[model samples]
Structures are given as structure tokens and as C-alpha cells.
Target: MSFGLVARAAGMFAVTNIDDILILALFFAQVRHRPRGVAIVVLGQYVGFAAILAAAVIGALGAGLLPESVLPYLGLLPMILGIRAGWKAWRERHDAADGDSPVGERSDVGILTVAAVTLANGGDNIGVYVPVFANSGTSAMVVYLVVFLALVAVWCAAGRFFATRPPVARALARWGHVLLPVVLIAIGMLILIEGGAFGL
Candidate 1:
């Protein structure tokens, strides 16, 4: 077992946007109408992340699509994702009308909708995590999966907790579009910096 690899995976998990996972959980909470559905969504997200991590590791090692030396370029992905998220947030913030109830205004979110939104929001996090997975071997991958799932579970629980309250739920729904992107952008920038971009 490589302690360094485990540490890197944990570090990458920490700085990435765990909040969007919550937003996704909130969307699931709204759609399922049952509080337990949030758990289902959380499970799905872990499965999806595990698939992504496996792909990154296998593809990098087997096909060599991602060379170990090129891992630093993963930093650029977060920068781009950050800028894209900031742009989307700015657009939504400016486009919405006054007195518009954001979350309550659109309550008919479906499973596919939640999935698509979750995947879009996960871009930066995926980019950061992929590189880390590529650097590690089997044992590190297991550690990564465990830690990532645990953190995601915690975040989803928080989202579901707030989503159960009418007032808080409404507030989240309204500001979620505006807030989610901003948080993602901030996290993306941090990932870029930590991924060794400054030395450039």
C-alpha cells in the first residue's frame, strides 16, 4: 500500500466540489418525493465515480491515453471548468427576473435530469480525481473509493436534510443554480493551483 498515493487521493477528494453532489442529492430528494430516494441517488453517484476512476486508471495504464508525465495538464482542465461555471452562474444570475421563485418555480426534475445535471457539475471533480487514480495502483484505488464514497455520503445527507424543510428547500432551489456554479468555480481554481500550475 502506498501511503503517498492514498494521501493524494484524499487530498484531491477534499478540494474538489463535494457540494454539487449535494445539489444532485437535493434534486433527487425533490424528484423522488421520498427522503430515502436521496440515498439511492447517493449510491448512484458513488457507482458513477467508481466507474470514472476505473476508466482513468485502466485507460492511462493500458492504452496510455494519459501518460503519467502529462498528469499536470489535468490542472488546465479545472481552470477551464472553473471559467465555464463562472460564466454559467453569471448568466443565470443576470437572466433571472426579480421576485422569481427559483427552486419552487421548477419542481418537476426527473431522474435523467438529475443525472445530467450531476454529471455536468462533476466535470472538474472528475478531472482532478482521474489523474490521482491514474497515479495509484490497486490498493490506493480501494482507499480512494472508500474515502470518496464516505465524503459523498456525508454531503448528500446534508443536502437531503436541508431539502426536507420547506423554507430551506425553497431557498436552496432558488439559489442553487446561482450558488452551485460559483462554488464549483472556486473549487476548480483551487484544484488547478494545487495540481502544480503555478510553477508554470
Candidate 2:
């Protein structure tokens, strides 16, 4: 109930999810001209973020049942995802330069698809959220949940806002492909090192 607790929760959630705004901005740019686009994008974000929260809860609870070393290997998911994203970006960049027309557009923009991408893109969040949730008291956990859920809205709005701005969206489109993979890889490495994986 303390203001400090609320402030800490707000900061943690915002910082942890900062990268998502970049991803979300691209998503918003893709769908912005469509009818009710913002609503759909926001809904997708909520569903995807909720999935992450669910995974964090499971990890926190299962942490006690699993071997201590298991946590470190969890970092592999994000690393693998990062590699895949990097490869995709490389292909897209080459295609763009070659005038080969990058990959065909998807015929559908279902919430499920968005949710899956969000979850995969956010794979690194699991490592951070698990330990934090595991250590928190029930009251603090509740505060964190409420704060994170609320901030997801703010995140979506910011992403959408950025998408409406041409220069920002274009710059992100040009650079985000490169940056996303690097950020994910960095986060994954940080998690592994902090968890003492591979004896490093």
C-alpha cells in the first residue's frame, strides 16, 4: 500500500516491457489504416502480455519443484528466438535492396497471431519476471499485476502514437529489425550470465 511499492512496481513493469513498444509500433503501423485498428492492436497486446504474466507465474511456482540449474537454460529460448529474428531481418534487408519484394503480406491479422509474436518476442521477460514474482509478497504481487496490466495500455497507446508519426515509424521500420535481435540477444546473455549458466 505504500507509495514506494507502487512506484517500484510501475518502474519495473515499464522498464521490463520497453522493448515491446518498438515491436508494437511496427504492428500498429501495419494495421493503422484498417478500421478499428487501434482496438485490435491493443487487444492483441493485452492477450500477449497476459500470456507472459501467466508464464512468469508458472515459472515462479515451478521454480521450487525444478532443479536450481534449470533456470539458466530457460535463457536459451530467447537466444534462439533472437537468432531467428536476426536471420529474418537479414533476409528482408537483402530482399529490399535486391528489389525482390520482401516476404508477402499475411492475409490475416488475427489476435492469436499477434499474441504468438508478442510472446516469442518477449521470451526474455520470463527470466526477469519469474524471480521477481517469486520473491514478492501477495500484496506486492497484486500491486505488480495491476500496475503491469494498466501500463500495457499506456504502452499500446505510445506505440500507436508513434506509428501515426511518419518519420518515427519509418526509422523504426528501417532499424528495428536490426535492433530487436541485438536487444533480445543481449537480454538473453544477461540472463544466462546472472544465472551463472555455462559457469560464466
Candidate 3:
């Protein structure tokens, strides 16, 4: 694989993976001060991404086995996730604020949970990844993997940077309870529309 080709592949991967920043940002906003909290989220992202990569690879190898229609239905995952998150936020808002527990004391961030959500959020990305993988040979795929893994670290750093900003952090904490799920649902809808799912 030429360096240029690998570079282009990296660019394409970044472009397709851009929307995930929002997902990561939201998750990062919920990070706790615990030693493993942020690490769990970061690791969860890789775990979830691995799942996506595996699916895309399979689709690429199988080529014709999966129907394109499956692509749009994946949107339902994020949509449902958004709906659930919205409900949770609403409930939390309605609950009495306990004086004993400071906000952010008890984190909702779970490694497996984050991984599951990431998987749902990324479900639609297979559409792009499958074709990219299919066109490339084994060597290019390896190059793509290297570029992708490195970029995932970069993405995590970016998310953490954004999350740690005092002003942005305050804003997200204040409004994210309401906004995050709406954004997630919108993402799901976009995926559906883009994939032509549900006759969109």
C-alpha cells in the first residue's frame, strides 16, 4: 500500500468517524473522578469500535450476504438508546436532590454500558466501513487498522480535552441532561435517512 493511499484511507476513516465525537463528548461529560472512570470510557470506546470493525470486516468479506436494508435499521439502536436516555434524564430531574450526594459523585459511566452504547451509536458506520474494507486488500486493511487505532486515541484525547474545559463542562452538565438524548436521536435519524432505512 502506498503511503498516499494509506493517508487517504485515514482521512476517509476520520471523516466517517467524525459524528462519534458527540457520542464521546457526552460520555466524557459524565466521567467521574475515580481512577478508572475515564479509562473505562476510553477503553469502552475501543471495545465498541472493535465490534464495529469486526462487523464491517465480516460484511466486507461476505460482500453480498447482508442486505443494504439492514443498514437503516441499525439507526433504531441509537434512536432507542436516545429515548431511554431521555427518559432517564427526565426521571433524574424529577427526583429529589439528595443533600448527601454531590452531583457527579455517583457516576453512570460503566465500561460495558459505555461499550454497548458506543456499539449502538456506531452501528450504522458499517455501511461505510464495509465498502472501504471490500475495496482494499489485506495490506491496505492492516494500514487502515493502524491508522484507525491511532486515531481512536486521538479522538479520546480530544473528547477528554473538551470534557475537561471548565466552561464547556459546566455548560454540558447543566444542559446535557436535556440535550444529549435529543442529539443522539437526531444522529439516529440521520443514519436512518442516509441509509434509506424505513423507506426514508
User: In candidate 1, which residue pairs get closer than 3 Å at backbone N, Cα or C atoms, i.e. clash?
Assistant: 103-173, 103-174
Question: After superposition, which runs of candidate 3 have C-alpha atoms over 4 Å from their true positions?
Answer: 64-106, 166-200
What is the alpha-carbon lDDT for the whole of candidate 2?
Answer: 0.71
Per-residue alpha-carbon lDDT of candidate 2 for residues 1-200, written as tens digits (9 for 90 to 100)? 88997897786666556657766776777786789777877888889989999998887777656677767666666676678778988877854334231112544565776787778867767766676565556678788888889999998988888866857655655665677667666656766787788998
Cα RMSD (angstroms) for every candidate in the order listed = 5.1, 5.1, 7.7
Q: Rank the candidates by TM-score, best first.
A: 2, 3, 1
Question: Lowest lDDT 10-mer window, candidate 3?
Answer: 95-104
Q: Which candidate leads in lDDT?
A: 2
By summed lDDT, the worst window of 10 consecutive residues in model 2 runs over: 95-104
Off by over 4 Å in 2: 64-107, 169-200
| Cα-based TM-score, every candidate | 0.60, 0.65, 0.61
Instruction: State the lDDT of candidate 3 residue by residue for 51-85, as single tens digits.
Output: 98889888777853557556556566657766876
Give candidate 1 regions above 4 Å deviation.
Answer: 1-11, 21-25, 28-39, 55-68, 95-117, 136-139, 165-200
Q: Which whole-number lDDT from 0 to 100 does residue 198 have in model 3? A: 67
- Sorted on lDDT, highest at the top, how do the candidates line up? 2, 3, 1
